[model samples]
Target: MSVATLSLFRFASLRSRLWVIGQMALARRSAAWAGSARFVKLCGSGSGVGFTPQPNWSVWAIFAVWPDEARAREHIDRHPVFARWRSHAIEDWTIFLSPVSARGSWGGVNPLIDPSAERASRTAGPIAALTRATVRPQFALAFWRRVPDISKVIGSDPKVLFKIGIGEVPLLHQVTFSVWPDAESMAAFARQMGPHARAMQAVRDEGWFSEELYARFRVLGTAGAWGDKDPLADALAGAAAAGRRDAA
Candidate 1:
């Protein structure tokens, strides 16, 4: 099937009940079309990442990949969810979507933890080479917190390739959007010291990620201009623009 990627970086103050209703309306419409044969599988998922004192003022990055833009647009236009946004359309929130040509993995390493940067650097080399060969449109983000550091433990063991994308909704929860080079890599990674698994075990053994939450997604599509915008948008846009510049 032909595939097109769509990513939306949106902001909302969870304090407003209308936002919740709009989401409900949209879901209802999608459910209505469930029986249609023209329907194609949509890999839709996203998460939020930010801090807002009020539950109402939260930002979320939502993304999904569709078979094509036409289907994506059709879903949005005829969906009951659009009605909920009539009064608040583009007011409290904004959406940006772009079509993805390909997808891949990139990762960041720390100088402090990897004081030698040997293991960190060495680990990335093979993984990067494999990802380049198998995946396209690669990107990575750096985190100053202990989370990523602790997370990398999983990537290094058993020659695991670390592929992590993180997102969130306001102050609620953080979602992890990740893609491995292949099913084998993912299976192997899962069997070893992957951070999420380690962290979960740590928490169960003790109490950890005490206040943090994470979700994972199999990316669908990505679109829109990045920078001076959402971080994820910027990354995807940067990757796309880079692809164009490379071809030129």
Candidate 2:
């Protein structure tokens, strides 16, 4: 089955951050790894909390999709980029996921999850949601103006375990990754008749995004910690309980 991993890195010092930035730029020049054998697609991005364009130098992230879990694990264990990140990051977290549902594309290619993958028999577990978009130049101002309020709504929701705003370029290319307790909770926040809903309508009406992708994943497992605790611990535990009850 197709597997995906999202890794977060936190650098405590300025020097480490600069080193990572240089390495990220250098990675793009090496064409040999462009169509890597193990990973189907990979993206490295700067992490931001809200809609702001400013770079958060201290934290960075890498999202990758693989043909299977074994290859994904092997790449993480041996890849040079991962090695460099390990050396620089003071704290890091990685989560493994399987596609629950996906639509749209990233950079004109739908890489993270395959739509044809068989659905899990259980659909009520922890959910990982990803939304990516390339903003049209003309609509950039209007798009960003509506972000802070929508972001606030998502960020303040108690059901959301973890959330981060990341992008390749500061303003034009943006993505958000969030983990929720369950699919229902995620839907509740997303389907709310508020700024979030209005923003979705604006995207469709104003043609704000030149390209966009929205996807959901089933959380398989996670390694390491964010802020000294596994952010999805509670969600995972609840999923485990549900699985046990179903088995019984």
Candidate 3:
């Protein structure tokens, strides 16, 4: 099965943090792991929503799609870039996922499994949602104008366990990764009559993005915590119970 991994690294020193950014950029183009990886993206987080033009020098992230769990594990365990990150980062977290649904494209290609191919055995597990965009130069102003309001709507939502805004470039290339209590809860928030929906409508009406990708994943497992505790602990437990029931 296809697997997606999201890794976050926190650095203590500014120099080291900046150095890793350059390293990740270079690795994206030249690393052997990148060659084998289905999709690879190096991202920076916004201070508040974790997706602004203002740089967050202390934290960085990597999002990758792998053909299977074994390859994803092998790359994380043995890749030189991963080693480099571990050496400089004070703290790191990685979450492995299985695509439940995906739409649009990243760099013009969809790298997730088709949702129809997988059976929807249960519907109570945590849902991981991703929304990314490469904004058109002319639309940057309009796009950012709507961010704060829309971000507030997302960050304040009761269903959201965790959410962060990340991007390769500050404003132009942006992405939001969020975890919700369940798929239904996530859909309700997204489809609600709010700033988020208005922003989506504006994006379509104004042709805001040159490229975009939106995907949802099933949280298979997670390593480490976002803060002091696992954000998806309850959801993971629910998933485990569902799996056990399915096996019976």
| Candidate numbers, best lDDT first, in rank order | 3, 2, 1
lDDT of each: 0.32, 0.76, 0.78
Among all windows of 10 consecutive residues in model 3, the one with the lowest summed lDDT is 113-122
Q: List runs of model 3 lying over 4 Å from the truth.
A: 113-122, 146-148, 245-248
What digit string (tens of lDDT, one per residue) describes model 2 on residues 4-46?
A: 8888889889899788878667754546355443343334454
lDDT of 3 by residue, 95-206 (tens): 8888877778887789885554684634557888898888888878877777545566678788788888888887798888988878888878867846656757677677
lDDT of 2 at 49: 47
Instruction: Look at candidate 1 and tell me the lDDT of residue 38.
Output: 29
- Candidate 2: which pairs clash? none
Q: Give the TM-score of each candidate.
A: 0.36, 0.89, 0.89
True lDDT of residue 2, candidate 2: 86
- Clash count per candidate: 18, 0, 3
